[model samples]
Target: MSTEENSGALPLPQDDPVVSAGLDIAMRWGAALGGPEKLKIAFEALEPQLKREHQLRLKQLDMQREATARAEENAREAAERMVRLAQQKRQHALRMTGLWLGAGVSFAMLVAGVYVARDMWWLSLFLWGPSLLAMAKLYTLRRSDPGDMQAVTLGMRSAANAAQQAPPPPVP
Candidate 1:
């Protein structure tokens, strides 16, 4: 047979004994078994196995896609949680700052009242009463809430009350 007929369409390496031997055996078998018809039957027999492999590969790809989607969803949830936590922290900070400012203003008013009492006693009384009442109301409102801030407000109110009851310092 011609080299082209022996090797079919592809060129066989004459230098490789193993390849040449395998090809020779295949060629002989093809001839013995009716060649093209036997090859077609062999390919048909292998089609199911090839299809199973393709299906398995598709399933693996689907699983990987689901895993990637889950990971992305988890990341999104985590980011949203972090944003909520940050917003809560900012809100707490603003609340605390407001509480501090309120307390400071009340205390300043009380101090001003005490200093002014040295001369204008009635006007000082007017300032002191309102400041004390505001402090008391603030403390009461905060005390209803359960936190360290509540305790701090209670302490501040008690100190203010104590200062209000104490005798004025002797005039210099």
Candidate 2:
């Protein structure tokens, strides 16, 4: 056999189901064979190199796992930050809307009061009717909105817990 065929196998790509399954089978075979004693002295000279390579591969996998975890944590934090930023923007806009609405309604009520005082009831209706209606609608929407941080955080926590609790697929 060519030396290339005798060389160690390539490090399997992380998270690859096929490679993982192949590795599982290989480990089972090794166990069934009752270890390298079966191969005996013919493979003895290469044992040190094999052990070194296995250790190196395990170290590499450890690094990959930690990196994957950090990447997931970063992604989760970024998503939460984005959600908070969006909520801040919505709150700011809502505050501004309320501020302007208050000012508009107060001025309209003042004008309507003046008109009522002058006995111009029809003009008073035109000034304050829509203002009151819009104010009522804004309050209603604010009450119904589900954009609070507590709600969003609860949803994210539940989803994360669900993912963590779920079992991996059968390896058969």
Candidate 3:
């Protein structure tokens, strides 16, 4: 390595701050340009553009918020409609079940009336029909209505048939 390369040396500025400031004044006086006025006009033009951009951003946010609210409202309405449809279906099923039960009860009563009339005419007329009518009225009560009376009646008939078929207990 050379000794000149190891020497601690630095370049110095050709002029001081006073000289630099004087040169700046002389150059500006020679140019005679409206520098600060042009800068002010540029800043004033940018202010309106920035304000417009900010307003547009706020409008976009508002529109998005409104769309979200509308979507939420639609979802809520759909849910309510689903609940209503389900309730309607349940009510229809209950009504159909009641109609079927009434029909079955009437059929059983008619068969019983025919059978009882052969042996006991007055008893069938005064007691059996009235008892059936009373039962029909009682069954019409909503709170007392069995949900699936057809299944229950079928179960009872099966039980009776099973009992008839079963052997009697040995004399114990």
Candidate 4:
């Protein structure tokens, strides 16, 4: 054999076509036994990649669960803060009402003390004078400002009633 044939170089075709066809068939058979068998080998190699994708999806779901829990905690805290603010407002309103009532009572008691000391002999005018003055002052205050604090409305109503129930005007 020549040096080219020994080194497995290309060879010239035979003159007979029938002999060439038979040689081609024998070469194909030899290749079927010597080379890789299955044509779907690339598809088989993708199994591990599909499993890795499933693991990544599970990790994403865990992250979403943690985020949802944090949001719920924040919402609960906001609701508690709103309730605390509402309670503070209610306490402030009650304190304002108490102050108005205390002012009304102190003024009324001071007037009564003055009248009782003035009429030492006759105890009758002393008893009615302070009450009558207090009622008159309350009515005048209400007429001066109609939209004053709502807390004093109860006392204002009683003063108005007392003024009306007093004896009517005598003939001139």
Candidate with maximal TM-score: 1
Relative to the unseen true structure, what is the Cα RMSD of model 3? 13.5
Q: When superposed on Cα atoms, how far off is each prediction in RMSD?
A: 10.0, 27.9, 13.5, 15.6
Q: What local lDDT score does residue 6 receive in model 3, on the 0 to 100 scale?
A: 52
lDDT (tens digit, per residue) of candidate 2 on 41-148 = 436767998999999999999999999999999999999999999999999998888767766666766666576644443344434454444444455444423334
Candidate 4's residue-wise lDDT over 75-172, tens digit each? 99999999999999997777666556646655665566566544331232333344444444454343323433342464455545654675554556
- TM values, all candidates: 0.57, 0.46, 0.55, 0.42
Q: What value does the lDDT take at residue 13 in candidate 1? A: 70
Q: Is candidate 1 or candidate 3 better by lDDT?
A: 1
Order of the predicted models by TM-score, top scorer first: 1, 3, 2, 4
What Cα-based lDDT does every candidate model obtain? 0.74, 0.64, 0.65, 0.58
Q: List the residue pairs that clash in candidate 3.
A: none
lDDT of 1 by residue, 1-172 (tens): 7747754577757999998898789778778878778978987999999999999999999999999999999999999999999999998887787688767767887888889877656546656664456554565445333444455556567656766777776788
lDDT per residue as tens, model 3, 1-172: 5323554865325378876687568546544645556656766889999999999999999999999999999999999999999999999898778767866786687787688665545434533444455455545544334534554455456555755665664565
Q: Please report how far candidate 2 places residue 73 from its true position, in Å.
A: 1.0
Q: Which stretches of candidate 3 lie over 4 Å from their true place?
A: 1-40, 126-128, 140-172
lDDT, model 3: 0.65
